[model samples]
Target: MSVTAVIRKNSYFDSVSLMSISTKANGIDGVDQAFVAMATEMNKAVLENLGLLSDELKAATTSDLMIVVVPSEGADGDELVPLVEELLVRKAPAAGSAEVSHRTIASALEEDADINLAVIAVNGAFAAREARKALDAGLNVMMFSDNVAVEDEIALKNLAHDNGLLMMGPDCGTAILNGVALCFGNAVRPGTVGIVAASGTGSQEVSVQVHALGGGVSQLIGTGGRDLSAEVGGVMMIDGIRALAADPGTEVIVLVSKPPAAETEAKVLAEVANAGKPVVVYFIGGSRDAVLAAGGHFAASSADAARQAVELSSAAASAPETLDAGQVDAVLARLTPEQVNVRGLFCGGTLCDESMYALLNDGHEVFSNIQKNPAFQIGAADSSRGHTFLDFGDDEFTNGRPHPMIDPSNRLARIVEEAKDPSVAALVMDFVLGFGAHEDPAGVTLPAIREAQRIAQEDGRHLEIIAYVLGTELDTPGLDAQRKALAGAGVTVTSSSTVTGEFARAIARKGAAA
Candidate 1:
């Protein structure tokens, strides 16, 4: 193996561009791994962890762009430097067509004082500082960067609250304000349903469902994932509820989160009860009765939340589509006796949690890398036992690489591994579509899905690949086309994660009984 590093002096690219370049380089033949990033301290640490850092890279300043590549045995490593340069050139904006760019919050504000929101996507260590500048300039914040200190988040939120402004997140990924999608958001029609979610994909899933149900969204607010915890006190949740309640365009408000602390849940429920507008709450593992008792509708899943929200706002309802009993039976009958367990590899953490709960509710002994119960937690992320569900988008899997949403390479590799296991009965996954997500996610994974199926078939085993695509028809990578691509690959594609999980559970139960 060989390692190479190049530092571009005084050159800078956004994190997303660097991540895309790194992902592209890592996918190159004979390349073991790659790191393309600004020389920020956080990124430097990532390079060190990957063992790709060099003395030159260590001395590089944050203004420098660093490209490090590791080549596997027998690989022509010399091509790496030229390849990195080529990718950078291709990714850069055209010389004469470049739009105006801002180097600081003050300068951006100077250019457009009407700018109401600032979306921060810098390194975590510098995120808070930039966010504070934005807040000081009277701008609402949508922080797309993670790894921010909790104390900084608390301080920023409190400051926003004091100024009667919104501070969305330090790790928030998706939000739609008025009618504009921001940072990792989807394009949906403007309507009466409004959402405030703590999970990125959760917001997308519910909003897309609302669109499909003939309803539109007025606003979508993301409070980051930690807003509902005891430490954060659900500050943004209550504020978002209040804001939407007062917005004349929003007839119904929906709240989504994985689960909240007891005190935080109670506080949010109190706000929901008092809000003049009807509320739909979908706390993935929270008590449904609690929401009802608080004068709100409780949804069983993200799709259900959107359905109920639409029903309340416009008296429209869309029945969830799921596989019939016969379809389930046929899939089970085709599986070999050795294929008895279900393997769920997901890019959405909330979806994975919801799937695990759905399987447990259906009386399956499921394990997951993200499960809170040690008994049900997989001992190793790379290994699966029993009916296992893994979140490839988790921080543990994304430490040095781009998120699975932006780069599906890791999940694709895992899919192949799961298919090779004789005990794997089914492979269930999610494909997220949006502005910052992969352009052609399903197209990229189609080959891997075919290969996995072929590997299973060659061993005289059957593999059931069930998936759900989360996005609206209006997204760049059209939802319909993505689903069509998956379906064309002989994969069962659904519209909801809940339905997908239920289908996988049904197959697993039937296979076990067989």
Candidate 2:
């Protein structure tokens, strides 16, 4: 599809629109275009990077940098500073302002209208209704909403498709265009690993793992949570694959989703048949018998997706073995039954899921939410209940990114807060590595660790610390030093999954002693 996107720097109204199908515009007047902002200076507080004319434009020469992204005449473009109320993904096929700061959606909606949009977008559900109105105005709807229902997503996607437009999502999280993330997404890794998934956390974890394995990514696309639902038709997932196949940079594709109904799976399999690139499909809990007719590979786990992605990036028929047994041993020992109770507090959903599964397998009764008599968050007093793996990323807390890998403060705070819980004994974290990631998660985590340790010591809790890092400082040089810094501070590290499992088992065995 030929895309024409425009970014206005001077206008106070900013928006993204998609122009689909042929349209008749007698003239600028007939087009019903209007930009009416009489403000002396409008504010732009963007949550995601939707691109200002240039990077220099991203900086605010005025006011507070606390604002996400703002509009100022500064050194950007000559067009009016577009008012983006809530910066979100821009797949407009047409352009509109986002991130309006405190401006009302109605005011933000009053943007230049010469070009018709096939879809209008806001970052997530906060803008769903407003986005729909723009869609009614012939915009091809692509929204960043994460909580949209399965049926709503299907209808919107279908309506857009019927009009020859594409609808992005109800819970769609991230999208990369020309290698830059237009949402709250990490920077592109830039390799042959192209991913299309029904899960945001799963996809993010896969991408992080791929990067850790010395592989980059061609593109990563999200198909929302219910894309494969029987009601939704799974069109986005299908189209995402087609788009990846078309991108020359992508040599291999990865598809991840929870199991769909049998029929939906069949349809997805049928669609996979035509793609020329080798694919690795992971349908969580999918049967081994399920196969992709086309030359596609199926993997049993997300980590396997990481392994396959590395294999695809290298031309060698054989995969590179970057395993370091030393690091592995360190991590495994921490999880050993003799360590301490290992509790996990994570921001990312997938990390929580993986940690829960791993800890459970290690023989710990993982309490996710404290409300269900789970050990972590039910009561202010209950948080102290030790021998728990708590995921702070559940809907109750996280405001934006679920994975603490992106924003460490909130998750770290949860970790420290949990450390104060008298019943707790140990803590575990995943040091996710990649671009747009905290320079050193362990570094960021160390202060919290020390505080937790200090509090534990004061309380006579004697908390043990262990971490499961996705990357090795050894492979990344200074990164190894960073890992060592944490180790030096008393946090043991494990190099790979095998070691993490061992450490967790140790924690369980140790917890039984407590």
Candidate 3:
């Protein structure tokens, strides 16, 4: 086996486009594994873990792009670096498309009077400035960049509110506007249910569940994850609630997020009380009584929220599906006496939080990087003690890298790492599908999954893998195909995020007894 590393000085590419390059490089023949990313400290550590960090790359800066490829035995690794670099070359513009380029937001708006929204995905330092420009131009803004200062976020959101323009996020990842899915959002039918969420994957799971329940969404607005924090004060949340309340097409509303600050929750619930339409609320670890007193229904999970919204919207929903007991028993039957913990490697933060909450509620001690209690926090990124659920999309993992949804390299590495642990009984995860997600998430992650199972079998233990795909039949890599692929790999693919958590809990409970 041979490893090759190449670096391009001062080269830069957005996370989304770089994902494409990484995907293409891995598909090349003779390649065993590929790592293509900017040489940030975190990325260098990842490369070091993969045994691909060369001496020259160790000195590379964040502005430098690094490509590392490991070639299979007998294959020439030296010849692969140039080929990988070729993937970075931008494709030529199609005929007549060259004239459409705009130098700034003002230029674009001046040229196209119909442009009403600007999607900002620059570095966090420059994100606020661009968002401010869009707001000044009377355009609604959806900022996808993270790492912006809290003060800048508050100022931008306040300006947007004062101008009567919608400000979606400083780190917002998903939204569905006018039947069009935007930035990591799933494809779903357009109908009466409207959603306002401070969680990206949380909103996604609810919207997909609503679609599965025979109801549809009119609009799914995202108010960046920090909207409900005390500092930000739920600016976009209140604005989103008002927008959906007055929307004629919306008859039922759903609000999803982790619990907000006490004052913020009260303000949001007060708004819900006067929505003049049925509302379903699902806030992780939040107060159900507060929702009930505010005249809104409280949902126990994402699936429950969708069911309530469907019923409130008067949609002809189908009966909810039940998990197969036989399948659960079959998995638990194979676990060894020493195997007892569930290690969830998740791409979606909300999905991770939901599963952790489910395990904790069932008397299982779940340790995670997102843990609220200091007692349950994992010691390190690679550490998994008891039941550990790690959200790979957390800032520590994604600070200067692409989210795991778009690039599964980090998660793929962690899968093998976790499998080497003797106490790990089951692996729980999520495959997010839709517009900005990977083209085929299951297809890309299958090799790692197979390798993990191989390691467990060699150790004479069974590794139960449970997964939930958050998407619909309408998504690019449709739900049915992704689930089918995983099921073929002997994975237990649950019907919903809630079911996925339940399945993991069942394994954890049985493993504990073993």
Candidate 4:
């Protein structure tokens, strides 16, 4: 393989644009890997890590756009440069366009005094500076940039609090304000359920499930992943809960997170206790008694949270059509004696965690790269243990690449790999749909599912593919179409990740018995 680098001086593109360009480049016929980003220090470090850095790239300024492409063997590296340039040009607007984009937050506010929120996704080193400027201009902040220091996050949140404003994230990925879906959010119908979440996909899962169950969301606030940590003190979570409580449009409040520090949890529960509105809590590893004791209801998963919130809001809940015991047994009965394990490949970290928790609670010895249970941790990320689950969106897999949400290539390859293992009884997966996600996630993954099924059949084995789509009908790449595609591929598409997990566990349990 050959690596080629191109530097465009004085060129600028936003984070979303760069990610799009990179995804486009990687899709080229002969390209093995591609990275399109500004020459910021953090991006340069990423390039170095990917072994795509060059002397010329190192000399490029932060204002320059750097494009790197690695060609597969026997592919002409030089030929791919034009393709990258063409893709960038197609993705970006003309340089001479009359519609001008603002260079600073102050200018943007000056142009539109009604602008209430600033979505910042710059390099981590400069993310805090831009966020401060936005806050100073009296704008709420939704930070989509990662790599920011914890200290900076605390300072930003404190400043936002002092000004009576909401700071969604320093690494926040999902939120819905008023009716606009911001940064990595899905399009759900607007209604009475408002959410405050420290997990991105966790909130998306809940909001989508609510929409699917004939309920809708009024607002969804993201508190980033660290907001619930001891140092950050769940500042944003408490503030979000309070804001949603005060909004007349919101009737039921839901809080979602993986697990918070003990002290932080107590403070958050205290705020939830007096929110007046009915509250549902889904702290992944949290205690149910704690929520009940705090005058709030506890939900076991995102799906459960949505059901409880919809019920509290007086919306009719669409009963989930899960696999019954006999159906599960019938499916498991078809599995050969050698097929005794379930493999889950997930794009959302929280979904992976929930699946692991469900399987473990079902008395299955689940192993995962993101497992909180050390005893069940995978020996290596690339190696699958008994009933293994892998989070493809983990930093290790996305160090210099677009997230799996943007590109399902890695996950697709792993699905095929798992299918080759005769011991694998079931393959469970999740497809997340929303803004900033792949336009045709189901279409992109359907080919792999077909190939996996083909391989399993060739080996005289049956591979049951179970999938759950986290999205609403309103999201682009409509949820109904995605589900239909998966089902057409001979895969059992469930209504939610929670239901998918339960079904997979049942199949695995019966497989073990067989």
TM-score of each: 0.94, 0.62, 0.90, 0.94
Question: How far out, in Å, is residue 263 in model 4?
Answer: 1.7
Look at candidate 4 and tell me the lDDT of residue 194. 97
Determine which window of 10 residues in candidate 4 has minimal summed lDDT: 376-385
For all candidates in order, the CA lDDT equals 0.86, 0.55, 0.88, 0.88
Model 4 regions more than 4 Å off? 10-12, 39-52, 58-64, 72-75, 90-100, 379-381, 511-514
Task: Report the CA-based lDDT of candidate 3 relative to the real structure.
Answer: 0.88
TM-score of 3: 0.90
Model 1, 260-369: lDDT tens per residue? Answer: 89999999999987899899999988898899999999999877898889889974666656557777877878987778888888988888888888888777888888
- Model 4 error, position 252 (Å): 0.8
Q: Candidate 1: which stretches are off by over 4 Å?
A: 9-12, 27-32, 40-51, 58-64, 71-79, 89-98, 379-381, 511-514
Error of 2 at 414 (Å): 3.7
Model 2: per-residue Cα lDDT over 1-514, one tens digit each:
1111233343332212210000111012222221211111121222222232233333433222211222232423112112221232334443566633334434444654543432234333335665556566666444654555565677666666566554667655555544655443454356778888876667766765676677777788777767887888688888888888888988888887756667777777777678887878887656556664444677756777778767866633334333455654554443333344567665455555555555555556666652233333352224534455555545445332223444465566667786776555567666655443455667767888888889877865456676765543323324467668778988866554334445555556556764
How many residue pairs collide in each prediction? 0, 71, 0, 0
lDDT per residue as tens, model 4, 230-263: 9999999999999999999999999999878999
